[model samples]
Target: MLTRTAIYEGTIRDGREEEFFRRVREELEPLWRRFPGVTAVRVQRMQARDEDARPIAMILEMDFPDQATIDACLASPIRPESHAATVEVMKLFDGRFYHLVGAATVLAPAA
Candidate 1:
């Protein structure tokens, strides 16, 4: 199994945080789920960090069977639609994509 993690690093623009999160929950999430070859999608909102200066606002974990699938999904037409949905929320963000990496640990859920 391969996991692709994308960290959307940025702080929500002033006065737009709530709207951004609301759209993520109401709109963007469904679009993310529609991406081809996406086996699983996990969305996380950053709450606290060791450093107060950290600007990361959200982290998204998308799992695929391989890098090829990940690449294909990015190239798919749905990707642009999903990206457009994200852009609606991104108007509230001040940063950019931080990283994209394959997972080093594949952990099983605790029983």
Candidate 2:
């Protein structure tokens, strides 16, 4: 599988944290779930990080079967809709967000 992760490398405005969370769950998630070829959509609300490192408020992961699937999805008409939703969600956040795609491996737990 291929996974794309987007990390928000900044803070949500002081008083807008709660609303930012709400908007992501209510508005942004639905749009992500609708993306073509996306097999899974995961959002991580950061709780802690290294003291010397910059804060990552959230992380979003979207999984697809392969890079070809991801490419097709990005080229599809729905791409613009997703971009528009992202723009709206970013309004409440002050951060630099970027995405990285790579192969995903699932390991079984050892007994």
Candidate 3:
């Protein structure tokens, strides 16, 4: 499986955190899920970090079966729609795409 992760690595614009998350939950999520070959979607809101670390406002993860599926989804018409939806909430963020990788580990719960 291949995962495309968009790490929203920044701070929320002044006084816009709640509105941002709300828009993401209500508007952007639906559009994000509309992409083809999207197996799973997750959004993470960052709570804390190190003193010198870049504050990550959010993290979005989309899983696909392979690279081709991800590429196709990126090329699809829905991508523009997704981008538009993103802009609505993007006013609350001030970061960039952190990284895109093919391998990741899932940690199991400790007994």
Best of the candidates, TM-score: 2
The lDDT-based order of candidates, best leading, equals 2, 3, 1
- Note the residue pairs that clash in candidate 2: none
The positional error of residue 18 in candidate 3, measured at the CA in angstroms, is 0.4
Cα lDDT of model 3 overall?
A: 0.84
Local accuracy by lDDT, each model: 0.83, 0.89, 0.84
Cα lDDT of model 3 by residue, 1-111, tens digit: 888889887778888889989999999999888999999998988877889987778889999998889889989999998888787678677776564857577899998
Q: Any runs in candidate 3 off by more than 4 Å, and if so which?
A: 106-111
lDDT of 1 by residue, 1-111 (tens): 677777888678888888888989998889888889988999988878876566778898888888889889889999889778877777778988754767667589999
Instruction: Write down the lDDT that model 2 would get.
Output: 0.89
* Candidate that would win on lDDT: 2
Please say which candidate is ahead in lDDT: 1 or 3. 3
For 10-37, candidate 2 gives per-residue lDDT tens digits of 8898899999999999888888888898
Runs in model 2 deviating more than 4 A are 108-111
Error of 3 at 1 (Å): 0.9
Best-to-worst TM-score order: 2, 3, 1
Which lDDT value does model 1 have at 82? 79
